[model samples]
Structures are given as structure tokens and as C-alpha cells.
Target: MTENRRFLLRRRPDGDPVRDDFELVSAPVPSPPPGGFVMRNHYCSIDPAMRGWMDDEPSYMPPIALDDPVRATTVGVVHASDNDDYAVGQWVMGLNAIEEYSVVTPGHFTAPVDVEAVDSPTRFLTAMGAVSLTAYFGMTDVAKPKAGETLCVTGAAGAVGSVVGQIGKIHGCRVIGIAGGAEKCRRLTEDYSFDVAIDYRGKDIEELRAEIAQAAPDGLDMVFENVGSPIMEAEVFNLATHARIVLCGLISEYNAEERVGLRNLWQLIVHQATIHGFLIADYAPRFPEGGAKIMEWVREGKLRIDEDVQEGIENSYDTFMRLFSGANEGKQILKLP
Candidate 1:
């Protein structure tokens, strides 16, 4: 129990992240330094964004250096602490590794969790967490969608995409969700209240585009694109004049062996459309407002959220792969014993 278990990046992944890309290793758990704490993690977040961080190239966040423990946000109970602010057994969330134990500095990567305000602890890592924040800001600030407009969301059955679609409905836009399979497409329309849904799996680019075009016969006023691939081309081909595309994620092409250029660039010019990419961290100062609104919607029964949780740190590697293969149902997370 006193030893620390960690998954270190063995090398920079080329295409898909394979199990061998990480090496499980152990070390004696270290005591917290001055103004720091040692935590026994209960859960670790597995995000698609983590894949982008695995590469050696520069990004909005730093890449994981070789041999360093893979970085992930975790919720844990304090096992020990040198900081006066955090007592032993205090619940906290912080940027920790996918390890059983972690030594975290107080401010830079750690924060105390507010358990009383939420329905459950894991909710902090779900609807009330980073995924929802990303959805909120991306839809509100950048897309800036209005009532009666047609909004199409890619990856709509997953965490962030589901949230975006619901928020679009709340704003009075007609929401269409594009998912990989028939079941997810049904969930979007039935469970998430998306007006329509399209299944992109087993369909070629042309076929998928036809489905997207059919779903949005009035043309797309805004696109909350989560799975960026040929789906982007399909969505682009259907853009209305002056449409806004919120580039939240590119899950489809994250691990592609070859980078394929989106051939619909000319459509942007033809439609006078605009696409913008954003980082959720850029809206850190507005977390209180955004978090409050999302929570309010949850309490009012206006938002629907789900999580795909796998037990144990041992399942971490396989659980992470589920995101790429579209095997996970919702927000993917790992629970540690």
C-alpha cells in the first residue's frame, strides 16, 4: 500500500496508442513536501485530449516526456499532507498521474473538492467537470448560436458532444447529432433530445455526407465538430452562409496513420463561413458562472449526462483505447481500488 504504481510513456506514439507505448512501473510512495499533500486516488480521468498531449510536438498543453508518468486529472482522498490547507482524508481533485498514489503541490495542480454541492463525487469529473465546461464555452462564446438555427454536433453520444447538443436545444436551435453507430444515434435523438441523428460507421464519406445533408435539409447554421475527419467534409458541404463551426475536438483523426487533408476548404470561402478552435482553460476565470449554469440545468432536469467507468488501474490502458475506437458509451473514466 505504501508503494506507488505508475504508467510511464515508453515512447512517443506514432498512430494509435498501443499498450506497449506505456510501461507500468512502481516506486516507493513519497511523502508530501512542504505545502504539499499525498493522495490515494479514487478515480483518474481518461480523455481524448490526453492523446494530443502524448505527442512530442508543442500544443496548448505540454507533451508527456518519455519515462514520465502519464498525466491525468484525478480525484482522491488525502492520505497525508504537509499543507495546512488540506487535512488527511480531505477530498481533493488535482492533475495527478495514473498512479495509486501521488504527491501534489497545493496550488499549481491541486484543488480541494466540494462534495456537498454535487450529487456524487464522480460528477466533479463528469457533467460538472472539464467536459461540460468545454461544451459550455465552446457553444456559448465561439459558436454563438441563435434560436431556430440548425446546429449539428459530431460525436454527440459522448460526454462533451452530448452536452453541446443539449445546450443547443436550450438555446432554441434545432440540434442534430452525428454518432458512429445506430444505437448512439438513437440515444442522441431519444435520450439527448437531438432533433435528428446520423450514423457514420460503415459508411463511406459520400454516403455519410448524404445522411448529414438529409438530416439538415435547411443547411447547417452551426457545427459543433467533435469527430474531425471526413465528417468535417460532410458538415462543410452543408454549411449555410455565415455559419460558425466550433472545432472542439478531432477524435476521428487523432491517431490516423496518415493525415488526410479536408478537401472542402473551398466551401468555407463559398459560404462565407468561419471555423475556430478553442481551449477550455482559456475560460478558467468564467468557471463559476459556467459551472453554476450547468449545475442549475442539471437540478432543473434540463441536462442529461452519462459516464463510462471501468474498475481498477489495471484496466486503464484498455479503457483509454475505447475512446479512439468509439467503444465507450459516454465520458470515459477509471476507478482505482
Candidate 2:
């Protein structure tokens, strides 16, 4: 029997998750049934959403059950198959576990990948996976930015944030990005085509507000929010009339023991702004439309994709921690041989 190493949830975390929250175990690989296939995982994505899944609270998706294999998205190659549609040696992406192998039914997943067209096999989890889709739908469908509008995106150097800012520019909006450091801020403006980028690491609230005013003199028409809490409180002060705020991931509060409250909520009512919190899964039905458009833009050199990959499944927890510290510049993934 083939042995598979998998990470199991040891306990739900109170603050930032540590390696102790997960336990690695070795188990026998399950044999594929009549219509199932076995996959050897190549890459697995580590997202901030996983933090929300740890809590047993109401969310777009169900919480990860205690003692269950840590839930994640993975790309793997079919090693054995009983399903006619999924032949051996084909590469596929699915909602799998942080494991060495998986036994999946064809119906519960997506079609196999065409590796030749993508820049890397891991791109399936980055540009072509849920990250890109979240940026596409959240910006285009939810925010609905128009020409000459001022667009502001928080977590501006992250996987989804970088794409969000670029798409804003493509639609003729003046894009401003808020990140954690000068290096990230520089990359957003110089490399990602954002009109202005602000570093929020050392800046006081007043300085941040002034920076926003300078970058977006007309105020912000669309705000793609990825970080919540203190930063979001500042964003509320800069919103223009009728502005649309697309609430994506809230990485800032993921590690907090107590929920951080926003102080400037009155700005929302006074500015007539709309704050819409969304999960990409809600728009899964329209994923193909968003994916095709993003892919087309990538092919035409209109969009840029960035990835920070850490080798081996054992490092998954540490790589995930990078998101909170701004150590990763883009979509963070773990490679499993």
C-alpha cells in the first residue's frame, strides 16, 4: 500500500495559528473505487480564508471539522484512475487536503490542466485558481469601477490585491494601493502600474489619511479591501460619495483574539457609500467568464501574476504565516514532491 503523509487539525487556534495546531500523520492511500481517481499532489495553496475556516462560525463555507485533514486547494497528477474522463498522468486541480495524495471522484473537481499554456504548474492555484477569480469578480462585478474614477485597494501587494489594482487601471481608473512597506509600495506603483502607493507600516493615522488625500484628491470611488481592522478604519474616511467598497479577505483580524471594531463607520452613511462583503464561492457560477477574461488579459500582456512558492509540505504552516507579516509578495504556495 502507498503511504500518504497528511496534516491534521490538532486544535482550533485562538490567535495566530502555529505549527502545534497541525499534526502530520502517515496513512495508507485509499484505493480508488469504480469512479474515483488517485492523485499525487504537486502544489497546495495556503490562503487567509483558511483562518476563517478554523472558527466554528457562520461563513460562506462550512468550518473545518476538528480532527479533519486540514482543508486546502491542491494541484496534482492522476497516478491511477477508474474514471474515463480523468486518465492517468493528467494534471488536475481540486479542493483537496494538505497531503501527499488524494482519492477524489471526478464529479467533485475541475477538469485537468493544460500545463503548456500556463507559465508554471502552480499558476493553476495562483492566476487561474480562486485568487485571480476573486480579484476579477470582486472588482468588475461587485465594485463596478468606471473610467476616471479613483480606485483604492488595500493589501495592495498581495496576490489578489496586485491584480485588483491593475484591473482598475485597465478600466481607466486612477488606482492607489495601500501596502505595509516602502518596498511593497514601490513595487505596486513602479511594477504594477498603480498611480500611487502608500506604506502603512510606520505612518500614523493622520499621516495615512493625508497620504490618501494626496493620492486620491477626488476621494475613492471604489475600495477593494483585503485587510480589515485599523487599516479599514482609515479607509472609511477617504471614501467618495456613492463609493463601492468590495470586502474580500480580512487578514488583519484573522489572528486577533478579539474582533477589532471600525471607528469611522459614520463615514459610510454620510458619504452614501456601500460596503459589500463577498466570498468568491458565491460567484462560482460565473467563474469561467472571469477566468477567461483574466487569462486573455495575461496573454495580451494586460495583467501580471506573481507567486511566492516555498518548497515542501512541512513548511506550509510557516509559509501561511508570511501573509500576516507581509513577508510574501504574492500568492503563497507550498510545493510537495
Candidate 3:
């Protein structure tokens, strides 16, 4: 008998999610109904945002239900289809959960993908994927950084922040990145080619503030925030006059019960700065325009991509923890059988 295995959400996590929080069970492979297609998942995304979806509370999207497959972006090739709009061999990406196969429709989260534009289809989940798209719209639309302006990115070695710093460079800004460790901080300057990098490994707030001030000596014109604890707290103090803080995420507080409070609201008022939180889904209407520009840069060698591809469906839990512990380099993805 053909069987499909899925990771079901067994419990809500405390500080960090463990393999015990989920259960993998076997089920019959689903057949696509009319106007639907079945996808054989190739690579599934392990994003920081997926951590937010497991809680039993309301937010941007509904929480994953108990005993249900966890939510995630799955890229795959369609193997069976009952719909004319989709072909059997077509490649697609969507919120297909952490499963080997998922039923999708045009109105669902699935979208057809073109893998020929970059080095590999995996780029569809990295450079040309939601990661880069989030960076593009966040910078161009929210931050609106200009040439000679200084932009600092937190979690700068991460999937979104890496793209954020690079895109800032492409737009003619002085880019600075803050990563957790020395190696990642080095990769930020050497690999992604950011102008400056600050290592927050064992540093305190004063140390981080001094580093930010030194790298961006003139103060920060924009902040592409990803981490939201001490990293964010220190950066907020260095904001230049009329600075724009695009709060893309708060990974530092995602797993905790009591969120780490930002104690520097006075800085925003003192500098007359603006802080706005944004979601990539909010800019869905402009995806084609955003995706096209990112791909153009990739093909022209103006933008770079780094991905940490881990194999196996059984390793999803450990693979996900890497993101929180700063163990994974670049975008984290898992290949399924």
C-alpha cells in the first residue's frame, strides 16, 4: 500500500521547539479532486515565521490545529492533475505543509514557478522566492533608502536579512549587517559583500551600539529589523534624524511567553523617526513586479544567493531549530523523498 507521512502538530512549543512537539503519521496518498492537482514536494521551507504559526492564538494567520500537518512553503512538481490550468509535470510552490504531497487549486496558496531563470529551482525558494521578495518590498516600499544613506540590517545573515543587505547595496546605500557569530559576520562582508558587519556573539548593548556607531559613523538612516531583542534595542538608539525603521520581524521574541520589551521609544520621538511593521503578504498585489526585478539582478550577477539545503522529511524538527540557534547558514530548506 502506498503511504504518505506527515508531521502533525502535537503541542505548542515553550522556548524552543523539539521533535517531541510533533508526530509523523502515515496516510493514503491523496487523489486530486476536480479543479485540483497533487504535488510531490521537492523542497519545503523552514522559515522563522513558521514558528509563529504553531501557537494556539490569533495573529497574521490561524494557528496550526492539533494533530494537523504544520504550515510551511513546499516547492514541488505536479504528478497528477484533474484541472486543465495545471499540467502533470508543472513546477509549483505553495503553503503545502510539511508533507510529501498536497492537493492544490488555483485559488489556493499554490503558484506556478519558472526554474530556468536562475542556477537552480531551489533559487525559487531562496533568491527569487518569498525571502528576496520580502526584502525587495520592505526596502523599496517601506524603507525607501537612497544613495549615500546608511541602512543597518539585524539578523543580517538570515534568509531575509541577507537579501535585505544585498538589495540595499544594489540600491547604492551604505549597508551594515548584524549577525550572531564571527563566521556569519565575515560571510556577510565577504560573501554577500555588505559594506560593514557587526558580530553580536558575546557582545553587550554598549558594545553593539559602539560597533553600529563605528560602522555607520554618521548614524543609521534606515533599519531593516529582523531580530528584536538586544540587537534591535541597540540599533534603535543610533537612528539618524528622520530615520525609517521597517520592522519586518521579531525572531528574538517568537518562542517566548513574555516578550522582550523594547525600552527605547524615546529615541524614536527624539529623532522624529517612524517605525512600521510589515508583512510580505501585505504586498501580494505587487509580487510580479517585485519578483521580476529580483530575478533580473540575479541573472545579471548583481544579487547573490546562499542556501543551507538539508535532506530528508524526518529531519524537519532539528532542521528548524538551526534557524533559532544560529546554526544554519543562509536560507534553510529540507528536501523530501
Score candidate 1 by lDDT: 0.88
Error of 1 at 126 (Å): 0.8
**Model 2: per-residue lDDT, tens digit, 1-337?**
3788888888998898888988888899877778889988999988888888888889777889988877889998998889988899998998888889888877544568888887789888987889999999898889997999999899999999999999999999999999988899899988899998889988778888888888887788999999986788777888899999998878888889888777889999999999898788777677668878998999999899889988877776788788888899779998997
RMSD of 3: 1.4
Q: Candidate 2 versus the native: TM-score?
A: 0.96
TM-score of each: 0.96, 0.96, 0.96
Worst 10 residues of 3 by lDDT: 101-110
For model 3, what is the error of residue 127's alpha carbon versus the real structure, in angstroms, after optimal superposition?
Answer: 1.8
Better of 2 and 3 by TM-score: 3
**Cα-based lDDT at residue 238, candidate 1:** 93
Off by over 4 Å in 1: none
**Whole-model lDDT per candidate:** 0.88, 0.87, 0.88
Q: Which residue pairs of candidate 3 clash?
A: none
RMSD of each: 1.3, 1.5, 1.4
- lDDT measured at residue 165 in model 3 versus the true structure, 0 to 100: 93
Expressed as tens digits, the lDDT of each residue in 135-187 for candidate 3 is 99999999998999999999999999988999899989999999887899899
